[model samples]
Structures are given as structure tokens and as C-alpha cells.
Target: MSQADHRSPQDHEHTVHYDGPSGGWGSLRGIARIFGKEWATPAALETLARQNKPKGFMCVSCSWAKPADYHTFEFCENGAKATLWELTTLRCTPDFFAQHTVVELLTWNDYDLEQQGRLTHPLRYDPESDKYQPCSWEEAFHAIGAELRRLDPTSVIFYSSGRASLETSYLYALFARAYGNNNLPDSSNMCHETTSVALKKVIGAGVGTVVFDDLKNCDAMFFFGQNTGSNSPRFLHPLQDAAKRGVPIVTFNPVREKGLIAFTNPQNPAEMLTGSETPISTQYHQVRLGGDIAVMLGICKHVFAADDAAKAEGKRVLDVPFIEQHTQGFGDFEAKVRGTSWSEIEAKSGLSQGAIERAAEIYVKADRVIGVYGMGLTQHVHGFENVAMFVNMLLLKGNIGRDGTGISPVRGHSNVQGQRTVGISEKPELVPLDKIAEQFGFDPPRDKGMNTVEACEGILSGKVKAFFGLGGNFVRAIPEREAMERAWRKMDLTVQIATKLNRSHLVNGRTAYLLPCRGRTEQDMQASGPQAVSMEDTFSCIQGSIGLRKPASEHLKSEVDIVASLAEATLPPNPRLKWREWVDNYALIRDLIAQTYPDEFHDFNERMFTPGGFYRGNAARERIWKTTSGKAEFTVPDTLDAAGFDDAPGRYRLLTMRSNDQFNTTIYGFSDRLRGIEGTRQVLLMNPDDIAKAGLQEGQMVSLISDAQDGIHREAGPLKVTPFSLPAGCVGSYYPEMNPLMPLSHHDQQSKTPAAKSIAVRLKI
Candidate 1:
């Protein structure tokens, strides 16, 4: 465990180190720094102790689930940081906004804006004053309601972030429908929409089939496109344990992240003292950007070929019984896999045939396999296909319903899956409008609403008159910054329910309101006597969370209260669903949710308190496929070609990534400690040959220009080029900052998730 040479805050030098393992004494040092100074130790320790604990506040950083019987001190480095970030003592009061105008704040970076700290009260933008002033909850709600009522309900967009609790999200969705529209676009649309879209078509379930226990017992785990060590650090403990138990962990990613190579358990005293780290990734394949489908196809091709040869020698390699009994379209899928040539796979995937063959051999040898992936697999042009192909490969051996095998889309957001489960969606298929209408006594809107991309278009085109964000930095999170800013300016009304000030708050609409909400770690004192909210983990375990700390501010409202009050003020009176009652109890919200999704969330509150919460049973997990075909199906796209990056010479496939120090739009620091990047966030990782081919030198100032069809060439840079170990023709840049280069039109055809990974760009040196 080499020590990270972190320079003073004054240093602005671009430092890049090639080798460093994640989560050793390095993580411990980070934990000490975060909890020691800024957060002042005591409060930070209390919050950290509560995170992910049974009947405690859940960490809203990532959705990785801990097993029912978990270790006592269960948290990762990033988890600790997230806890401190939320539980910070700093306050962003009305005086803070008064000190800096919106225009002035816009000039500040995302980190600087958020570091101003927790919003102290609800505020309404006063154009005359040119500043945010404290506004009473009633006055703000009434004003927003009046504005919303003036606009067509269909013209309003309600966006939900994954941070909201299931209880809050259910009320949010109910509020949207009761207010006369179902235009609910959420954070999921940006990240895991492909997982939902693809899995539903293939396995009849939109989410993963495996639980935390399944992962622990899996013989082999295939991590595709997910950097678990950075994104979900606690997952490293399981991977290390699996390695210790002789279970092979295979990884396929374009960048060679040190987190995937080796991990030192910060929780273990012996490992930390001895500087011993567990080596993960028995096999690492640097598959090219947007080439996941081809690589998966190549692996399947090997499996089929190996099975044929083994059968010829009087041996069985494939699960023929499972394939015959529980799956459909295998013949067609097998034929297509066999048809793809090794040359095409080698060229497209940037992986030699031997690597893919070896991965397939590992897959074949394992009795029970778990497939895990993150945004890297789901943020591409072929994102849906990438997800489906993994399912197709797993279904070959009937891995769906078993002790340790199933699909796992490791979500980055804590309650992203929970948000969707409670009905935060733009599409109508997931929302049972009839049930909602009947249960709530209103004719819910039946039309499909705008997704995140479409919402931007709607706002820009003057179709969406009002945009309400129930927690998210929409401007920073979305692509086309200028266009989104312009669109936001065009909206008649904009409302953001947030914990702190972000770039989205600074980018105001014609009439903007910033409604401050309590952070996930804060206590909620409701009429029902200190209410507790529930959040479903990525594994669909709905666990209860009760905040142990005081509210950031006395004026801060629960998201449920904000949404309920806003709904009451906006919509016409409806007696059947008493908004106040729902807000007061929350258990009533669960009851309503049960009414809406009876089959899955039946006896809602009753089953919620059970030891580790209840798992929403997936039909696919039980090998009872609920698809139209009544069996698990293999669906292949027309072609697995990744064709955009080759439009011209010097064009490279750019993947937008988050620094280890950051979590989604929120920038924690300029340095990415594990990556050896210090004192800067403007560094771009590129291949050495690609840099030379583009006539660019290391640390050269460069602009990344995207190939645009709308006449406006999108570009973001003046970024320092840093050559690193990456596949040829592929480059990496930090996201949110690089989001401008990603066009709004560039998205998955099926899921409409912005193609954040496969951008074709040329360097402007």
C-alpha cells in the first residue's frame, strides 16, 4: 500500500500516478480527513455509525445491499464521505444567497456551489431583489400551485431523484397523477433505464433476480462495465471473500481501474497493518467502448462451440435441460452467436479471441454465476442490447433461479430501484393508471410523458411550461448545458426540492423556487410520532430507515410534506385520498402503495418490519417467466456494431466517468485519490498512440468536439490530456463537466438513456 502523495490545497499541478490499490490505509486516511476536520468528528462518527445499520438511516450514495447477517462495522470509504457530505455543519442560509447573486454563483464550479452547504430554509427567487429570500412553505406552495394550475397539466414535468425514500416517492407519483398528469421523469432514466427496458423483454422482470446472499455464494461473478470498488466500495469485501474462497471474479471494462485489480479491506485491522491486499479480477478484459454486446456475443459463441465439442466426446457442457424446459429463442440466439466472426469480435471488442474464450471457459466451469453491471454497460448506444445479451448468456445455464446466479444491475443511486418500484416513470406501462385513478378518485392522465431527454426537449421547445425537480441537479446531470439552461429560462415556473444548493438552483426559470428539504440522515417528526421511511435496495429489499440526527434546519420539510402540500395546493379537492392524512401517517402511503401494486407490495406495512425487510419476488427469479412467450427469451439486436467513432481520423470514443471522490453531479474534491489524479479535475485520460495520432502531447490543452447533426458542434475542454492505459481509440473524461459534449439526441433507441459512454469526438489542440 503505497502512500498517496497528496499536495497542499494551493498546488494546481496535474499529478497522475499509475499504480495504487483502492481501500487500504489510503481509505482510512480519507475517512479520518473527512470526519476529522470539516465534519468535526463527533457528528460524523454518529452519522457513520447509523449508515446501513439495521433500523437505521440508509446511505443514499449507492444502492448496494448488505446481507441480513452482516458485519458490525459495515461501510466503505465513499460511504463515509457521503455521510459527512450530508451531515456537514456548514449552512447555506438566505444570507449566503444574498452574499452571492445567481449570476455570480453560476460562475462557481459545481463543487464550490455545493460546498456552500445545507440549505437552511425554503426560498423563492425575487426578481426585483435579484436574490433568494426566505419564503413560508404555504406561500411558496400556493404560488407554485397557482403557476402550475395556470399551465396545462400535460405541459408540466415532475422529475424525481433516486435519493427520495419509497414512501416519499410513492406520494410524489400520487401527487403527479392526482394533479392531472403522469409526466414523471426520474434519475433512473439517465442510468438504469436500459436495465429496466432490456430485462423486461428477456426475463419478464425489469430488475435483477439475485440478492446479496446470491452474490456471496456465486461460484463466479462477471463484473461488466461496473467499477464496484469506487461506485459501491463495500462490494469489495464480498469480492475479496470470494477470492479467498477460490471463486473467480472476471471483469470487462475499458479502463483498468485499480479498484478492480486489488482491494485492501479498511475494516480489517490485520490486512491494514500488514499492508496485505486481496487480488480481485482473476481475468480482466479491456473491452472497447460500446463493444460490450459483441464481447458478450463472442463469449456465448465460445460456450456453444465448446458445448458441441464436449458433446461429440460424450460429455455435456451446456445446460440442455434448462435451455429446453425454461427458455425460448435459444436456437435463433445460438445461430446468431455462431454467425459472428472472430475477426469482427476481435476488432470491435478490442479484445483478443483468447480472452473472450477464456472468459467463456470460466463461465462454463462455474456451476452458479452472477452477472453484475453498472452505468458503463447501460449508458451506451447499444445499452439495452448489452443488458439483454448478459441475460441471454446467463439463461443458457438456467442461472436465473438458483442458489447463487442471476442478473445484477448494481445501481449507483441508493433508492433508484425503489423510486421506480413506487412509480416514478415517464412511461405509462409501469404506472397502473386505472388503479391509481380508482384508488385516488381521479381520472389519471393516460398519455406517456417525457423522459429526461424528452423533458429537456419539451422545456426547450416551450411544450413543458413548468419543471419540478424532487431532488436532483437537473442542469448539471443532463447533457447540453447551454440548451438546458436556455430551456430552463423558458419555463414559466421551476421548483427544486433539494437538500443543498446546486448548479440547478442557480439556473433559474422565469419564476423559480428552491424548497429546502431534510437530508436522509435527519429526523422527521410527523403527526404519526416520528415517522420512518423505507427504501428498497438494488436487490429489492425494502428496509426501514429512521434518521438519528436532528434536522439540518428547523424550517426544513420532509420531501413527503413538501410534495403533499404542493399537491394539495395545486389540485382540486379529492376526499378519497386525503393528502394530509397520507403525509401525517406515511403508513397510509404504504397502504395506498399496496392498493396500487398489490401483487408485489402486499400487506405493505405489516411485512416491512420483518428482520431485513421483504424482497419483492421476481418471476424470473423463480424460473416462472412472465413474458409474452411464457419463458425466458433471447432477443438480439439487428447488429452488434459500434459505428460512430470512425466518422473521421482522430475521432475517438469518449466515456464520461466520475472521479472516485465524486458521486453523481456532486463533486467532493478536485483529486481522484485512487486514480493518482490530484489537484485537478480537468485532466482527460487518453491512449498514448491516440494522443500521438492527434498531434497532442501529454498535459496539452485540448477541446473535445462532438460530431453534431444540429449544426452546433458541442465541445467541452481546455482539458489537460493525460495518457493512461486505455483501449485504442477510447478516451475518458469526468462527467457533468463533460456532459455538454454529449448531445441530447444521442440516446438509446429503446430506453432513451443518453449515450454517455459512446461519444464520438475529435480533439482540438
Candidate 2:
């Protein structure tokens, strides 16, 4: 029987509607609910007004760029929700912590724990009392510093979140290096690291080539493994406009998402009132999970076939001229495409040859094509190969250096791009070691550092002694959560600089400190009056953001202030580097960044005042290939069929996904209105055929066992099975909840990113 047939009113808090256009009154209702849950109408309205403004704070949601031309209401529903959540007046004080023990809090799910509210002050974990008690900021810092000094620098790991501003990120790297450590891991390491690794090899740049304006004018756009409506709602505006302008959008994902199919702009009053929706994807191809590489190859094969046909007719359809001048490896790449059998492509991609041809026809007909992908493409075992395949497809048409053509990876986190720009990478290549030593008067380490996955392994292996996090739930976000948490307990000290309490805070070491800091919604008054921090968007636009709302608590410190103070306590006085000056005047930090990266960030402080901020120059954007070959080079893909990895009996492929109600590790609410799930985050989305084959009923609860080669125990669930429209042999589950099923050692070889999108599993009914 179908899940719906057995589902009772008590089984779900709300009915699950399978069909509806995304982003209409439904989005408005969701926004209203956020305000109701977190803030009063006045506070919500005030916070919404300030979001994404040039003079105000940037939204803490996704890192999609703001338009060059500013709109009054630029924020999306989730953006508004994030602003409300951050600016909420509710506080979780020392008394709240005193009422709960770490062991008791560990039993609470992620949402319930964070929903308690914003942390008001610094706290230290007391092992004797089994609870967190209030502690002074100075004492907290001194204690952390003492521990840092007690251990070897190589034993300490510095982890950064994308929410950190450019100023704070720069300071963080500087502090880590000066204090004699090079182990820097950031949010990028877990999400877009594959993009960085793949793109830099082909284009000599780790970031996307196109700016936000490129989307408005692009002739055709291809979305691979990305749900634009849920992950980046603000990005849908340009897409909606593109559709209205008659541009064809092609989407390739496992599930047919409502956002990609059609969207009614909440910003448009007429559309919202009349219920008129803009159809987004002209052609939607539901490729199976981990099938992106095969699908990309199939499309390229069709493009080649068209090129040969056009040549036979004495006409050039492909950009041969541009390709000859700006790209390399066309001959070998074309040969491979020709050699790739249509049957293999169809079998691997789970799409018919006709469908692939149809999408290819749309791509070939357009003068300029833009490729956009997200974690869905980059969170696989062959993720680096997957991204390289995308770049290869773009290079075939000479799409990298044009008005409306380039590769754009939809990066997560508001400042994830900025974090990398300001040198939060485990592999810091942008700024040379000699130059950094010369500029900052300190010898920076040249060796590559540990990534998120490697950092986890380091801790478990006893190589890492101390762990420090700046604004992310590191323990909860990574895979093999239980093992990582157990390893974390072995640390000499753990420090978390955060705005709110999360699962990471509860996963304590012998000595742990929760240094509550001011969120982006709160005003940061440094020694030099009010300050503004700059962040780089996915499109490489750097803009200033200053908070206007009052501080959540008087005891809370700004990120910049906290980092500066930590540096003061940890490192001996370095006359050459004035931590206080940079902390007090954020402009000074930008000036230093300009000094460190003169070519791209020249006149950085002055550029902040520009209307939408300046675009950091991209070599590929101008058709100047900075690669070793002096041209974009096509690389071969590792696997045409990701399903080949499942060679064992009773194995099924699983994809970990974010619910519409969640952003990254933060669960906003239980209901995923877009996906039609309500009041539960533990449901497993599966195909009915798969459910039947496994001898499981549609609504039956089931446990998932990982097919990890390491022989480690990794499992999750008692997850409610909701038979959906996934491809046979594939299942979907929410992330962070399903994170335990991911093995620490199972990651992309090139990038060290956990293969969160593709896990081999077996159903246990």
C-alpha cells in the first residue's frame, strides 16, 4: 500500500501535498510562520528592511549575489527567516544551561536544541557538574590560550564557517599561522572544495567565472543537481526573468522539484495575487543520483554529433574559432565523446537518448550557455571528475569567456567564497608564503593543511590535540558523527565561537568553551565606533555589511573583536601586526587584504562604497586562460556509471539532501512545505518499486546500514519510509540526520569532500 493510504492525521502534523508551484502564497505563509515563531511583526519588518542593503547586514542564508542594481525587497523567504532567527529577542542564559546537562542535551535533536534561543554569554563546560556554567570572556580566552600554548601547534586544528566575514577570516588565518599552525579547515572544504580543485586545474581560478548580471542576459542555462528555489531562493528572480524573456532553462536532477518546474515570485504583487507562475525549466531531466557525470557526457556526445553534421553541411555550429583560440584538448575530448556508446550513456544516466538530444539541441541553438551546479554534483565519490566533466562541456562550446556564458557553482554559506578569498583554505595558494611572511612579518607555513574529513581522521587517530571552531557546528556537520564526537572527547581543549547553541557545543572535550558572539543582525561597536565587514559573494562581488539592530546581549562580542582578543591572548606581541587596529577599523583589514592581493583587491577599501561593490577580476572571464597549457583543458571523467560501486547484494544508492525548511546544518522547522513533508525530518524518500523489492511497506520504519569498505559501523534511522518518485534502487534522506551513514574515509579523492550525495546502503525493515 502507498504511504498516503496508511498515513493518519497523527502520523503527520500537516497533510503532504505533492503538487503545487513553488514560491507563491506558500512562501509568504512560510515567511509569516517564521516571524510568528521567532519575532514580533515590527521586529521582523525592521530586520527584513535592513537585509541585503549596501549599508546594512547581508542575509546569513545562501551566498548568492545581490543584483548590480539594488532592489528594495531583495531578500527571499529563507533570508527573511534567517534574519528573524538571528535577531530574535529570546535569550538562552546561564540559568538555561544550568537546568540542562550535556548528556541530557545530547538526546535532543538539532532543531529542538537550537530553538532554545540565542546564547547570551560565554560558557565553560564543567565536567564535575556535567553542565555549562557562566564564565568571563577574559578567563575563557586565557584558558583557551593556555591550552594552545601547552600543546604543539601542529596538534591544533582551526575550523572556520562561511558565516565569518572577510576581515575575521583573514585574522583567523593570520592568527593560526602566527601561533605556529597551518591546519586550517573551513566550510568550503566540506561543500565546494571539489569545485575549487577541478576549476583551478582547468581555468586557473577556484571561483565561478560569471557574475550575477550574466544570468539576466544568458541565452540558455543548464542546472545540474541544484534546487535553486530551496537552496538559493533569491537567485530565482533572475531565473524567473530569464524565463519571461523566453530563455530556455534545462534542469537535471533526480527528483522533479517544484522550484525548477515553476515559480511564482513572492516579490511580485500581481503574480502573487493572481496566482500566475513563471515556468522555470523548459526541459526537466530526472537523472538518477550520482548520474550527473554520465548525463554531462551524454549531452557532450550529442553536441559533437551536431558539430559533425553541421561540418558535413559546410556550416559551423560550434564556436570553433573561440575554441581554437581559448581552449585545448578538443581533439582528444571529441574522440572520447565519439567513443562513448549511446547505450552506456543511457544506462548510466537513466535518461533516453532522445531526452539527451533534446537538451543538447537547446544548448547548441543558444549563442551563450551558462552551467550552474551545486553540492549534488560535487558530493560524490568522483566529484572532482563530475565537476571536470562540466568544465569540459563548457569548453567544448567556448563558453567560459563571454557576456552570458561561464561555469557557476552555487556555493553555500554567505561568505564561503569570501572565506576562500581571504585565505581560509587548507591549501592557501592565492597568497604566497613568502609574500605573507614579507607583508605580515611572520613566517607562514607552506605545507598543505588538513581538510574537514582529514581533520576528523586526525582527531580520531590522536594526531590532533585541540580543536577550534569559528561559527559552525563542526561535529554535527561532518560525517561519522558518533566517531567524531568520541574523538572530540579526547581533545585537550575545544573552543567554539558562536552566536547560538548547537550540537557541536554539546560534544565537549575535557575543557570546552562556548564563546557566544554577536550575530550578523546585531550591531558591532568596536573601539573605532560602528564598523562594517565585507563579504565576497558566489559571483565574486565584495560588498560592505553593517548591522543596525541592537546587540542580542551586552556580554556578546563581535567576531572581529573575539578573534582579535584571542590573538592577543594566544600569540606573543607582534609589533608588525596590530590586531587591535585591524579589529577597531575594519577598513584597515581591507587595506591589508589589498596589500596581500594587489591584483584583484586593489583599492579594496575605496571599492566598498561603490553601489553594488566591485567584481574581483577573473582571468577566464576575459578569455585569458591562466592554466598551465595557457588554455582551458578538457579532462576525462573517472566513472560513467556511479552505480557500478554498488557491487554487493541488497545494496541501494542513497542521497543525503537538505529539507526545504533547513539551511546547511540548521533546521529551521520540521515541515518541508516545498517537498510536502510535515512535522518530521527523519522520513526516507524512496521509490515504490524499491520499497516493494525490499519487502518493506510504504510507511514502515526502517534502519539503514552503510556499505562502507572500512568495516566500520555506520548506520541511522528508524526513518519513516515515504515512497516517492526517485529512480528505482535509489533513496533519499535528510542530511546531518543521515550524516552518520557517511564514512569519514569515504570522500572525494581529489577534494576530501564527503560523498554525501552517494552512499551505498541496505534497508532493514
Candidate 3:
């Protein structure tokens, strides 16, 4: 392997500690640096100002809810980066591809590959020339259509990223089902599938129950596993606001995330001038990696014990009435919690009984509380149970279906939840397939479809023949990188619909096509007029995103248009579904969505652009349990060590994370300002004691080998070790880079989501 493949050299002489608060001058500088790097013009600034506005596009960086009351600058630092990156003038024209062959391009780093910029035309791979050549859109579509016609529908994987607008995602799902399969594995499969699966099973809703207003009114907030500083910076604003209001915000995460510690709101003039920072987390506990469930169990145990004491004093602590009326399985769940020993909790959680009880004390004191978490809680073998346990904690006091209290799984991509809302899932029961069949006049596939892991397996076994990527870098984002790369190339066809060049494009199949699509910030014009697409945020709010800037390339088409055109080419024209009309008029697509999911999308177009849009309305928020039990159920975990990782000596639970510069496999830069790491994504963050125990010094290069029992040896390195404030048995590294260390089979059996956050590994010098 080349040095670049394993090593990431430090830019600074030593790790630079950023002492300043999160999102003050540091954020401003970061924004400036990104804008300068992208060569963003004054027009880009004007366009950014419109982001998250009533009439503007949604920020593409995160799924954080946009407040109804918009600030002067609603977008955050990473949001600016996402917008500027999209608004960049650079173009990956045919000349650029001609200059570099597929093999040559494969040698380029992911950041450098995307830095080549927006794809301006439809391109097709030529095996003879070993380069991608420009081709007409019609030719590309025809080739894809012919390949699909030849292959069984079950063999075709229709993959989507969260970047696609709701209208586009809705259409993509329709097209895929019409072409005759439900192989709709999306970005959610890698991250928050656990949240959906667990939440749906317990509460009858797949999405978060809280709204933007909940943050403002919430008496106290409990955050687990999520890092707001890197993944969703906009959320820090509310956290800061809540802090200033004296709302106790308790956090339990392995890493001491700078965002949760404190924040300096750049938009606040008083704080900016005074150089003051608001302390966000009242109590921040660094739990062991994959130990959230244990910590949660301990908290619940403490709460139950407190309730027993309160009963003797004639003061009821638990919301007994609410629990009795709206929930079930409490008796069995409480028994399980009471049975779990504190010794096991401390051993597994890497936290003391005092720390766990302290958190419980805060939880019991609050009248209303919100439980917020991210992929840190979701990307595990028991990720589904992690979410269920969190919900159980909230349920102890009737936290759900009330103001200032609910569960919020902060999503990564801006429209990831919306994609699922509009019918993007491997499971047919999750979506309105029968309604779709009735509306579109086609029998939608009923068999369970392939998720990310299953799709990778299918590809490797030569069962999956075609890959239609709507927006994500699928090959890079998924686990088992080396295996997937080899399997991906063997596929019969791969169609990537994206705005810029990424690594997935270079990993070409036998027949490959790259169709350039318009970015979310660009004006999408069709036969009718200027068009707008809707996106659903983590808060379940459906809002319209209308592009304000000119198209990057005249040849570029909207995702809606592209999906429709591809559908028309692949499927025989259905009289009931007007593909041409839907593409021209996006409103018609929304109408179809409303007809299918009337409860959520009623009068979709009418309310789409209504100020901050409309809430799709989560049933769980209304205390309506859609589960088979007809009540919110409390789930009991099988064990404290949720992932069931063997307690082997010298073994470390590897937690893959994102740097402040990146957003879900898209590397923006080398620096992770919050972690004090600079110019390297390959450095592993470890506890000082653990580093010394392994006879490894800080900055020492080492290989991380997966401890999985699978026959295949999974290893990634020479990653530099950096001593930091992580737990003794845990280590942290950037994701996608560390994805190779996680075996594809190591995932949540219930949700099928890869346990990226809790891979078992050991260092090799």
C-alpha cells in the first residue's frame, strides 16, 4: 500500500488545543477558510443568507430543525461549508476525466477527488479507454434501462442519500417500485435505522417526537452519544439558549465534545463583544463506548429506587397515572432493571454509581425532559436496544406526548427522515406500498428488500446486478470497504446521480454512468416553471426548499427530472402515472404523496411553503401507540454489554467519528478543530493509560486489527495514536477511514444497521 493509503501526516509540530468556545471567532474563521478554498463569490454569500429562511432552501449539512422564528443568520458554520461547497465554481468536465484514468483517479484521496468539483454532463465508462467519456442523457438512460430490463428487479439496488429533496425521493421510490422491486436501501441504513426500528416497535412512530419549539420549552435535556459540535452545529444554538435560560442539560458521551461543554453564539452581539461562552452541559459524563444502554439502565434503576422511597413519604415520584393509561410492559421492564446489579453497570459503563445516580437525580428533579441522541447511540450491534432503553428512561416519568418532553434522534443528512417518510425503505410494511399500488396501478414488490449490508452481500455473491445511487457515496460510506470495492466492480451496472465527483464514481462496474444533477441551492426549471422540493427535518417538519442560484451547468437536471426520465426509460408507460407531467410539475408528485400518506402529507403542496412549512405530525407525540400492543411498550435489554463484545485483554472498542470538516464520508478538510487534531484524519484518540498500557506513546504509528471471529482479517493503519479524554477500553478514529476495520456481518440483527461505532479492535505496533 502507498504511504498515503495508511498514514496521515500532521500539519502542525504538535496537537493544537483550541481553547476558544465553539462557534465564536473560530466558526467565522472556518467559514472564511472554506469560502476562500472554494473561491466562493459575493453571490454565494447572498445565497447563503437565504438558507433555512422561510422561502429559501434547507441547509444540506444536518437534519436539525429550522426554527419558525428565523434568525438574521440561520445557517451555522458547517451549513456555510455545505452551501459554499455546492456553490463552488469548479467543474469536473470531460477534459478532467480524460486527463485521469479510472485507475489514476482511484489513487486520489476522497477530499481531492471531490475537490475536482461538480460534474457538468452525463458520462459513461469506456473499458477500452479506461476513462469516463461525455454522453447524452438519453444515451445514459437508455443504457441503464436496457441493463435493468435484462436483470431481475430484485437484483437491482436503488440506493439514495439524504441530500435528495422529498419530491425527488418520493419519485425515486415510485420509479424503483414501478420498475418492480423495493430494493430501496438509503443513507439511513448506515446511521439511524436503529432509531426507526426501535422507536416504531415501542411507540409506533419511526421519527423523533419533538419539534423545534420543544427545545425552547424543555425544562431539562438529556443528551447521549451525540456530538453536536461536529454532526449538527445548528443544534448548539438551542443548547446555548437553553443553557442561558438555566435549563439543566445533562450529557453522556465517550468524547468530551467541545460543543456540549460550552458554546459562544456568534450571532449574539453581547457574547461576541464580551468574549463570554455559555456552559451547555450541566453534567457531562464520558461513558464507555457502546455502554449507553448500561448507563441508561443504571439511571432507570436509580429512578425506580427513588420512586420506592418517595412512595413511603406519600409523594409519588413516577408518573403512575400517565404510565398506567398510556403504557404497557412497565412491570416486566422495571423487574429487569431492578434485577440488574450496579456492579455490572459500572463495569460495563466505565462510570461510577455516583455518576449514574447523579444523572438520575437530575432526571427525577425535572418535571419535563427531552432525551436527545445521535448515531453514537444508533450505530451498534444493540443500537435498536440502545434507543429502546433511552425511550424507557423517558417513559418512566411520562416524558412522551407532552410539551417540553420527547425523544429526538438527531439525524445526519438534511432530508434523511423525509426520504423514509416519502417511502424509501427495504421493509414494505414501513411504507404505504398497497396505497402506492392502488394509486399508481402497479403491484409493488412485497418481499423484504436489501438494506446496505444485505445489498453489499448480494453484490459480493453476484446476486445483485445493478446499483442506482440517487445521491450518496455508497461504496465509501458502507462497511467492509475492501470487500465492497471488489464486489462493486463486478456488478453489471452502476448509475450514480450526483452533483460532484466522489470515490464511488471511480469504482466503476461493467456498465457505469454518471448523470450530473442540480444542487439544492440551484434553480430547477422545468416545463411548468421554477420548481421547489420539500424536505423533512428531524423534528418531523416538512418544509419546501427552493433554489435561489443559477444552475451549475445548463446540461444539469433536477433529481426529480432525472428520476422521472430514468423511470420513463426503464418502465413501460403507466396510464395512471404521468412521468412527464410529474417531472414538469413537482406539485403533482406532492399530490400523489398526499394521496398515499394522507395523514402526513394532506394538502402537501398547499402547506409546503407555508412559512417554516408544516409538521407531518408524529402519532407517538399524540400518545397514540401504533404498535401491536396498542400502548407504548418498555423494552428490556438482554445484557449490559449491549454489543456482546468479548472481554478480551488489551481489546479496545473502536468508535468511528466524523471530524468537524466532514459530513458523512465527504471530507471537507484535514483539520478537526474541536479535538485538537490537525492535518490528519488517520490519528486514533485513546486514553493515556490505555496507550501506556499497550506500550504505545502518543503520536506513535500503529495498525488497528479487528478482533472479529470472521475468517477475513480486517485491518486499518498506520494510524497515529493521540492520547485524549476517552475511556480506558475505547479508542476514537475518523469514519470511512476506519470502516475497513468493521466487518459487514457485524451489525444490529434487528435493524441490520452496521455497528460502526463499536467495532472490537487491538493495536499492533
TM-score (all chains, Cα) for each model: 0.96, 0.97, 0.97
What digit string (tens of lDDT, one per residue) describes model 3 on residues 389-441? 99999999999999999999999999998999888988998888888878988
Please give the ranking of all candidate structures by TM-score, highest first, separated by commas: 3, 2, 1
After superposing candidate 2 on the true structure, give the runs of residues whose Cα lies further than 4 Å from its correct spot. 1-17, 642-644
Worst 10 residues of 1 by lDDT: 1-10
Q: Write the per-residue lDDT of candidate 2 for residues 213-234, one digit (tens) a residue.
A: 7887789999998988789988
Score candidate 3 by TM-score against the native: 0.97
Extract clashing residue pairs from model 1: none
The residue-by-residue lDDT of candidate 1 on 1-765, one tens digit each, is: 111112211122333553557889888887777665455447667777767877777887898884566667778888888888888888899889778777788889888888878998889998787789888988998999899888888998899888999988988888888777778989999999989999998889999998888867899999899988779988888888998898988889887777887888877889888988887888877888888888889988888888889899998778889999998898888888888899988877888898789889999889999999998888887788889889988988778899899999998888989999888887788888888878867887778888898888887788888889999888889988887887688788989999988989978788999999998888898998888888888898888888878988999999999999998898888788688998889898888888889988999888775655689888888998888899998876666744334445667888888988889988877768877788888978877777777777888898888875568878898899997767888889898888888888888878989889888887887
By summed lDDT, which 10 consecutive residues of candidate 3 come out lowest? Answer: 2-11
